[model samples]
Target: MALASIPTKQYIEQREEGYWIKGSRVSLDSVVYSFLEGETPEVIAQNFPLLSLEQVYGAITFYLANREFVNTYLQNGEAEFGQLQKDCQQRSPQLYQLLMAGQARLSQAS
Candidate 1:
C-alpha cells in the first residue's frame, strides 16, 4: 500500500493592503501577531471569528515556513503605518488630537 497525499491548503492571499486569509477579510498579520504573543491556534480562531481552527493553523504554518519574508512584510507595514500616522498628525492636528484623546479614553477604559 502507498501512503496517500493531500493537496496543501492556501490560507493566505496577498492583496493591495496585505496578506489576508483566503476568502476572508481577516489579515495574516493579525493571526501571526497573536500567535507570536503566545496565543494558541484555538485562541487565534476565537479572536478572528472569521477564521476556522484549520485556517489559523495553516496561516501559522505559512508564517513559520516563510518567516523571513513575513518578518520583512511586517516591518514594512509598521513603517508605512507610522508614516501614515505622522502624515495624519501633520495634515489635521485637531482631528489627530481628538483621535488621540479617544484612543486614550479607550485605553483607560480597558
Candidate 2:
C-alpha cells in the first residue's frame, strides 16, 4: 500500500528557520498562538484578518502533525526575538523606556 499524501494546496511553507503561510507574511506560529489562546479557527481568521479560514485550518493541521518540532521551533524563535529585543533596547534605551511605560499604561487600562 502507498502512504497517504497531503493535498496540493499552497497553505504553509517550511523554511530552515520556521514555517509560514504561503502568499502571506503571517507566520505559522501566529496561527498556533491564536489557537492555543482559546480561539477557534474562525476566530483566528478573524483576528488575523489577512488570513482565510482555510489557511488557518491548514496551519493548525500542520502544527498538530508536528507538535513537538513546532514547539521547539517556537521556543527558539522566542529566544531569538528576546535577544533582538534586548539588542534594540541597548541601542535605544529611551525608546525602550517609553515602550515599557506605554505597555504599563495599557496593562493598567486593561
- Scored by lDDT, the top model is 1
TM-score of each: 0.92, 0.82
The TM-score leader among the candidates is 1
To one decimal, what is the Cα RMSD in angstroms of model 2 from the true structure?
3.6
Candidate 1 C-alpha lDDT tens digits along 5-105: 98877888989968999999998899999999999999889989988999999999999999999999999999999999999999999999999999999
Worst 10-residue lDDT window for candidate 2 reads 10-19
Off by over 4 Å in 2: 1-7
lDDT of each: 0.94, 0.90
Model 2: per-residue Cα lDDT over 1-110, one tens digit each? 99899778868897766788987889898999988888999989988989999999989998899899989989999999999889989999999999999999999999
Model 2, CA-based lDDT: 0.90
lDDT value, residue 17 of candidate 1: 64
